[model samples]
Target: MVYRDYNISIVVTIFISLGLSIININTINSILIFGQNNVLSDVVCEKPGIKSISASGALKSHPPKNVIDGNQNTRWSVSGIDSWVQVDFGEKRNICEIDISWYKGDQRSYSFVVEVSNDGKNFKEIQSTRSSGTTNDFENYELKDSEIRYLKIIVTKNTENNWASINDIAFNMNKEPDQNLSDPKTEPESPFIPTKGYGDNIAVAADWSCGTPAKKTVKNVIAMEPSLLVVPGDMSYDNTGDCWLDIISPINDLVRITLGNHDVDEGNPESLAKQYIDHFKLPNTYYSFDYKNIHFLMLNSETDFDVGSKQYNFVLNDLKQIEIDPNIEWIITVFHHPIYTTATKHSPNEKFRDIYHPIFDQYDVDFVIQGHVHNYQRTYPIVFNGHNPDTPIVTDQHKNTYVDPTGQIYLITGTAGRQNHELIGQANYNADQYKGFGFLNLMLSNDGKTIKGVFYSNNNGEIIDEFVVQKTGAIKPINPDRNYQDDKNDQDNLQSNPLDSLFSDILNSTPRYK
Candidate 1:
């Protein structure tokens, strides 16, 4: 009896050792998707009542923390690393929207690739975009209805501004897809295309003078997808010694050139203007282009608005016809001189304002964007030479420090390749001065709900400044309220400012431009 008992005990011990060896082999094969930890098995943790699973197979009781440290969230800030985060739906769930929020200051550009896997070994890329990029805000995406057990978001580019402080991310899942959110009335199709297509209908303001930086700026803008480039003035810094042709020859095929102050004269002042008129193929130094129902008025700031000139007569005739286009929802006038500039480095051009503001006001022009101050400033939409508290002005006049109400929306987006001027810190604009060499990316959404102006550095692709203009129909002009409240003109009701108490999330730490 004792010998038989010993034999059974030996057999049981051998079987137990074999099971242990099999378990160890499986653990070694499991790979980690992020961090240094090994992957936990789904089968071992799959209890009958488990709801959700995080990176660890333990019961995920709390949501992920909003950790903003660069090292912790390095995926949000830099490039060349394949950093990623994963979300498990517990079971096959239909996801429609994903809301990812960053700290109020962590704006940067990076490409996002989303993937799904039932077995957690393979992933498929869905949608990708080069975000003009957003800082300190939430980016919401309405994805097509998808059933995903494990979802992964891989960050290809590092978040530029924030040290990687991503706050909270929520995966919105529904039993049934909400048709309203699925097909948003406001959201338009993707603005950027995979090919060498212009991102949107808006134009890029470029100046190819001041050496290679200008040439690089033009090429980068073309790559980013601009509908067209509007070189309002100053194609080159100095035209002396016949260097103008060399500077413009390379980019001429890519962009439509417009004459600027430096390009017209400086060396051969007598015939320089004629040389500019002949080479650029412009219709007498001023012309217009109609695209997707938007009218772009490219004017010569030197001639038309300078005392009495021939270009002035041409501008008058051009406005007469543009004003009558009922289909033209937006009128964007580009030039070199600013109508209302608060840059202490350069004074506002009273001469240009007197020449153009009347026509702009009479026609209810949507926006007037110019580049020449070598610094950047935007004014609220106010009438010319008028100061009303209710009016919108871009100057830093109010003690509250927001967009001026009683002024027109004027922008000086000049620093394409030229050196940025030091901001003069004074009482009026001491708090809101940005001196950097950068360019502007102005986008008008197809729905006409928002106008986004993105200011990125010329040297490196750093987005320095951003602002949005919300349109209220002709019913209310210079409304100081925050929200766009609708009012019946006959009923005498008006809404408040759409953005009453908002501030910019992106800070000016290292000025991106030269």
Candidate 2:
């Protein structure tokens, strides 16, 4: 009887050991699936088995699932205002961040608020942004220490016809294991390095948008490998700030921009301007910077430009400072509105001409680059009365090269790519004009004494217009009786004539006293 009891005790001990082993296995499986210590993967939202996605309303073909389909080409679009889309993870999950790719995201700005919920009923606001404009790129926002299963994005405002569209949504979830692992033996590719020897070449363009002919122009510009890019105005026609950012972010650090009318079209102008300021990290709307031997002044045409206005005073002081700097050989002014445009659709802005042209003439500004007319126009070296287009006194008719010009040369190159081409009818002041998509490339010599302007057509990849401006010592007299040739190679033989005495005196006199 004692032997039997000993065998039974051994069996009991074995049963208990098996039970404990089963419990431990279950615990390990739980840790692997939903443990807090798991490493999060880069693309947690793309994982299968999402609970559900719902939206306030969806257009006929665009359902809310398009946002979670991991495809940027597809989108969920709603026609009404105050639309929203929400996603549920089925179980409580730790969401650390959310990313969104906008749809039709150009030229317009979008305003939205992000909220999170634990029970899918009581939601709490986590982040609110006034204007989130970007195209074909994901804008990520971080969520701090909050564990929730439901995420909702509410669109409260938009600059584009009250439509709400989102291309894709992504999540960075905490406590998620990274399933993607490459072979340890494989080597990684090297990063891209731009070619040298083109550092001083600057590319100038405006009114560019993604997925358009301008995109090809931008690609050409990148291929040229310019050191810097100057966009005068009218960046994205859709007012989608984010879209513009996405299109230009590849060269973000190299771009210098000025404001345009389209950039400030939101309900609250201050808020809209703030979006631009924050994105570019600009000191102010109108500011100046020095690059190489060129001094660049970016003005705001939409703002007040009266003599007593802040912008006017800023320009006055900035020009004064630039004039005294001996190192600055060239003064290039950039703004949205053209002071002198020959396009018949939109005439020259009289206010800008009245308030700022005098300052430009006073400083003998080298080049004034402007947009807003949707074409390319290069004027003859002209001196104006600061209030009239008909008053443009052509100081020199030396076609492509002006040797010691008496006044600033104005260029309207708003044809980077926007709308239909403006009618390029005949204009007396316009030396050359083209109604096509193109950009101006300015090559400034190292000494800053000469600038070569070349307008390249994106459609045909040909040079449409070209000019050279050379600065010599003092102003020389001009004679109207002498005929000037349009040939670029004949510049060296051209000389100032005695008949241009009046222009010579004006050039020699201080413009501040005029």
Candidate 3:
């Protein structure tokens, strides 16, 4: 049955209370509720039973059984890190989402991994993520896995204390689609038809060295299964980049990387850069690629990017050409070093900002993603301030949404589980920052008129930051005399990329992956 009223969402839980007399716990199937003005039709209200539960070791009063008792007040607590709670669902089911309410989850974040098993002996990792530190309410974690009988939650650590505790846990299974919803002849009419998601997404990160701290982050990216994977730099800090490459082998060919300071081995290049270049089959140290409607310019921060330099001229001409390209609607520049960072470990790069920022603004570069700071930060759509590089002129005042924003937005997405660098510098034009393990997922709308950027924390369902840009609308004009123009005659300063032709054949050659 379709539910049009917003209150009908309560029908999901209310269905159990309304029809418990006729329901059978032994059967797991969706009930077709007859109703008018529907939204979610053929909703599944039955959940499987928990046969048995065991924990690494539970407190005397708060036993593992408390988790299955369906009481939010009671909980199961363990001493500390690596503590686990396992459950047997008696039979296999197509699990898709898990809901968990942690003890004092509103106060602190809990880092945990979910593993599932079919046979009681072997378990496979389903998800390694954290809890939303802001809520004690049940946080729903979506999954995409086949039938599984056993489930386990391995608590890595908690931010607040040495206790790994949980108030409640539940699972949602993915049911077969309703025939009416699947058949083209029986398609229903609703608002969803027009706004359905067909947008392409690119997952980006940096400082992803192979370690326990980085494992969860890498797994999270694999689960995202983005159309493209771009790494700004600092892939493997461990001498050879093979370790990190092996971990991300599933999406190796689709990954494009920039040379970070670490990737260049602190002034010593070649070996480390070669690993990523050879492994991923990059065309050059710096090149351009077009994926869907978004054009990506891979800038090498380790090399010469100064004014009148080869790198500078390449960037100038690249932006100039992309400006006239009718097919390209969005442009993103990815590099290793952040020019506008407030992190004390690596403060802002004054020369880099003055040289490149205005150029980015000139070409209407929508977003810039950088690494090297080992944290996440984003600036409001701001134009370069010639008076003081530290202070940029804010073009759009809005925080999370933009309507054809005037200036360019810069982001430091180095939070790939490597470690958080301390932010000791002044927060002059900073918007927000997150010192956690995560990556940026930039999504282009199906209509090709909008783009959404979401910074997702590794393993946790927490979205550190989110923004939407309606590119089709008129740009909110900044100052009438605002100077974003920076022109350079680099017609002669051209380097040919055998891979990226005039039309940027990169998008055509590679089979796009989801």
Candidate 4:
């Protein structure tokens, strides 16, 4: 889509401006090389020159050929789960990008996987992603360069309906430059800096969608300038999600969200949730990441999470390994539902309290952040009781502060642009509660021993609630009553790279820092 016009006169003028003498062919080559850093400076690549386009099926007037006809009005519309659109380059060619304009893209998103092949019989999947659903124009999706003669898009499902339609599509490719620089003058580029961050402050809030509350919530979040923004759940209430996506565009790079009931899979292969995942480039619905000395475990409450289930096993094994690690100083779990809450809208789940509260106590988890009640509530560092789930063993009842806490303290900051819920009576377990639109600012101290939780109401910038959690001494497990298997640890075999294990995803794109 880009065209560059460079003439010998312009090159000579640039060379003359640089005060060059004895200009020859080699000197001219050097000047050309110096003019740009890209090796394919003179290479022209408009499209892959699609020889033919075919699809599994099409409606009456719409056909696959319309996709490559360079017309936005024409499109290929098909309806099926595994329906596909294939394109041929006539010969093997190196491709690195795909530009496509989906029909009615402004209304809904489409999910699909792209596969490429040198031979027509064997294909390799290159990327699994979705469209922005906000643009009818061409959106370029980059990929690794591979030589292929055949390419196809396998449509899974679109968000709005079962139809898969594309207005225009193009595969851009580049051939190896034939020109060689006899006298090169290109300097080495500087080391790349990461587009994301890992710093002290972590901003948290949830249940945000649209309207004035959502806009004000965004302002509050950006005001803190947090290195990381963790939204527990209930992110985009709208199925199209254009509203939330537009509002959060300012801090999309630093956001990490968990799955909520509203964000669950719809069996349209999880129509809305999958779109969110692909848009954010997340590894999965639930995952773990380490920031500085803190280990953040994001869980999916909408899916199965029983003791022997996949998510349960994941967290159990994950925490067992982190138990002995010397690097991790704090453990924070994030999810949608709450195990302990006095809010009457959504009653606390006794099963989660019985199953995970003991695990969090065992693994020395510090905080459990959740969103679902549409209000804010904080509890004292408490341990679970299977026989008596109503009254948890409140370890530290200082009300406002805990020093070297005995158990994991749970906090529900669900007041992130949603209807507020009222608590039952004066609950003894609740530390501080608020019913308003606000955000939770977890300010990590310089020594990394204390994390002060501050809830600021977005309406009047009032400090509705505040609490302090400090690890002033060694972690002492409460030895709470439990009925679960305890794995063995030799302490001698506790050898692993927590840094590499936690940060393997970002290593290729960023330098490690917090």
Candidate 5:
């Protein structure tokens, strides 16, 4: 009897060890491997009959057949009545935009409504819209936010009167699409919620680095609850080779990258840029997106800035086409080059200024964002064309002020998870400047009419800067004289404090694992 009892105890011990290993595997895989790759694995459960059951179709929520015709380019036609396109975000996210492409050009009157559900049995309509474009190709649409797990798109009628066909459907999330803010689901065994998230805010660090300290600082900043992460150029030293990729793992899903000059070399001047693309899937080196009512255009400074170049022409055409939206009240441009810097480290990219400033002026661009100089600086609205010092200025909103006749409001925010350099000098339209290693967290109101930029450090949850911009319809109010400009403000030009010393080593080294 004693030997039998001992055997039973040994069996239970072995089982417990196996279960613990499985749990650890799940936790590590969720955080490092599967989640970063945007892939979710199958879940298994025990059945009553002493068998294990595996769940399939967890990520296979593709649109149904006969929903949108992808081959026909003539008209929208429908055949099957029960077909519908469905998207499961794994959880609910702020529905910022939906991009669609229909094969039938000019044939279908694009109109659709969004129906959402938690359990997929019962559904409710959240928002509906008529076609925003004339052609079958439309991109970057705003979506509503709630506790949405399953999303269904149904086509009631089309211009072709047949069926609707689509080639691609891409969606964006404010933060994690699966993160539920109001309530959280947790396992009873663990005290910490596995899927905690940061709200929509940008992070900054006085002295940012890629070493352990910088890594910790960045992780802390991301933990503050930001919807996205924006790192100013100089992300890693020597383009930091492969090392930068690991440093960014914490905020990989919510990152957008712009290359600093340090990212490239004589051989592969675009290597760093290419690496960024390989790691993160952006539409292009420079592209545009319409979130809510705002139009955001990202540019490539290292690329061509002169007229006639492919990149330059693309920018022109992009702005021209974007003007079709009457609802677009604000235009924000992002790039790596600084066109309005007053720092003595280097001169402004005048060639770029001459090439693109006029187009921006013509289109009434409101905000221009750049990185490279390791400091935080905000500029009042001003023009670069050198046409009229008396050009009118128009402020986009109260916190975001611009010149009267009109130029663009240039903001330099490069202090995230990296080291900071002191501001050597000043500029004509300088509004605010700081030396810190942190990031900018921006929140756009549902309509995109108002935006708030919050700058904070991750080390201690200290908010160092904050500003708000409200759209006034007109990007430039039309300046009769060039007299309207915000007061040229200045602050102590101290070197931005470093987050921690350990980060420097990590950022400066090459990546170990691919």
Candidate 6:
């Protein structure tokens, strides 16, 4: 009996040991799995040396290299539907995530499938989704643990035209940690000054595209060596956002932009607005600045402009302050929708005129530059009673010059590259009209009283239009009233000015061009 009891005890001991051993093994396995996941999270999969990239077709100007160049300003563009870009890793890799920064990402949704392949030729679909169309930020897609050496992004559909563009691409490898994964990539910020002085000539143009006159127009603009380039609106026709930037890279740093219908017409208007604001580093949708003796006001016709709206209040307040500043000799307003146009495709934006024309006359604005007409039309120094353009209450118009103009000179210079629309003949208020591709090169005199504008055509270097604006005497400052004082006080009370924040690095810094 004692012998039997001993055997039973030995068997129980063996069972207990097995149980302990099983529990310890599971605990170790759990710890290892957790550690591996953490390590995978830190691994960056985008190692260009180990991968080869190819696209179905890319614009000659925009190549596949641009996708991996780490520059959002550059991009790879593919024409037509079912366009695809593939990245082939030399060897199989454990990929956990993929990130893509798309071109014109702010405006349109894109539908695509992510496929992976072990062999270079045969691919199996792994993931697919419709993008949210946020341009300024990357859209990240997480994948299940899979060994993939070759990856392909097949774009099946898009909300915009039949063009697909990608600014940058990235991946997260699952096996090991990568230092680049820890390094945060960010868009480079350009310098901007809220109120500064500039003396060189300013080049103004709009409606640039990839077509005939656009490239030629940009070439001419580069040769001009102007201190500033202001494109009022309709900067790009192709939804590939980087196309326009690439075309204008030579003068990009010198360029400033305003929103146009074409700019905000795609995808989500709000998303496009955010992207525009971020890409340009604008303080807001509307802001003012001083370049040399000129006070420039950039407005957003796409946004709300009715009285009491944020934009309206900003404009009214901005003009009031500029009216009191003695250094300001000229007030030039720029926006997408023209207050006056002779093109039959689009009529004068009477809504805009009724809202802002009175304020312009009240402040004695010098010039108003606009786009969206696809042609050039300059209105005489005229005032309006909401419906009709009438001669200014207190102004004069001569051959090519205006003396003491009572109203703003409306210049519609939209002929940059897009095809010109047929004009419905000249209007009674139109001082000049032209249907061609060209830009305005305005030279402000040293004395800050004369503005000589020359419109150079892209087709054959012909001078399409030329005019001059001369100020006879000092600009009368708007009378300082209690309301004006209160506005100034409110502006001063703000701890951080939006302009200062948007251009913190460059606001007080020395002018880049000056």
All candidates: CA RMSD in angstroms? 26.3, 22.8, 19.4, 22.9, 24.2, 24.0
Rate residue 453 of model 2 by lDDT: 75
Residue 59 shift from truth in candidate 3, angstroms: 60
1-514, model 6: which lDDT tens digit per residue?
0000111100000001111111110000000000012111211223434468898888887777677666777777867666777777688766644566666667776666678898878887765555566554665444433566787777766665667777766543434432112222211132111123233568898876554356667767776667789989766543335567777888877888887865664333345455656776666666777787888888888778889977787778788888788988899999988877664556667777888988897888888999988788876666555333432222333334544455677898887865455687777667788877777877776377767676766544566666666677845444322222133245443243333332232222212211
Please give each candidate's TM-score.
0.49, 0.56, 0.55, 0.55, 0.50, 0.54
Candidate 2, superposed: residue stretches over 4 Å from native: 1-199, 266-271, 386-389, 475-514
Q: What lDDT would candidate 6 get against the real structure? A: 0.61
Superposed Cα deviation of residue 215, candidate 3 (Å)? 2.1
The lDDT for every candidate, in the order shown, is: 0.45, 0.61, 0.64, 0.64, 0.47, 0.61
Model 6: lowest-lDDT 10 consecutive positions: 25-34
lDDT of 1 by residue, 1-514 (tens): 0000111100000001111211110000011121100011000111121244333211132223222221223212221234455666567655443445433333444444556777677777643432325444444433333466777655444334212223444333334322212223322232212232112534455433443344445545654556656665665554341444564455454455455555543344335566665565445556666665567676766554554555565566666777786666667777876656553434555767776776676666666777666566655444543453222233223222223233345666665554333455532222233555546766555265445666665535566555555444443344345322222232322223434433222121212222
Q: What are the per-residue Cα lDDT tens digits for candidate 2 across 1-514?
A: 0000111100000001111211110000000011111221111233424699898888778788877676777778876556788888887775544555566444455666678898999998865543344444554343332466777877765554666777766543434432111222221132122233212567888755433445555655665566678887766544246666776777887788887765664233445556667787676777788887788888778777788977777787788877788878888899988887765546677878877776787887878988877678898887665334456767677667666886788888776655323465757777898877667877666266667777777644566787767776575443434332242335544554432443333223211100
- The most accurate candidate by TM-score is 2
Q: What is the overall TM-score of model 4 with all chains considered together?
A: 0.55
In candidate 5, where is summed lDDT lowest over 10 consecutive residues? 25-34
Q: Give the distance in Å from residue 236's predicted Cα in candidate 5 to where it truly belongs.
A: 2.6
Model 5 lDDT tens row, 1-514: 0000111100000001111111110000000000100001111111111011111111222223222223223222234322245655565434423455554534444445557787766988754443433455443333332545566665444444434445443333333322112112211122211132212344332223344334545555555565556554545553334655777786777666655554542123355556665676555666666654557676777665567866777777778877786767778787776776757334566777767776788787877788766567877566553554323243322333211225577777765533334477666467567765445656555255545555544334445555555554544444534434432221211122132232232222211111
Candidate 6 deviant stretches above 4 angstroms: 1-199, 267-271, 386-394, 474-514
Per-model clash counts, in order, read: 34, 17, 5, 0, 52, 3
Among all windows of ten consecutive residues in candidate 1, which has the lowest summed lDDT? 1-10
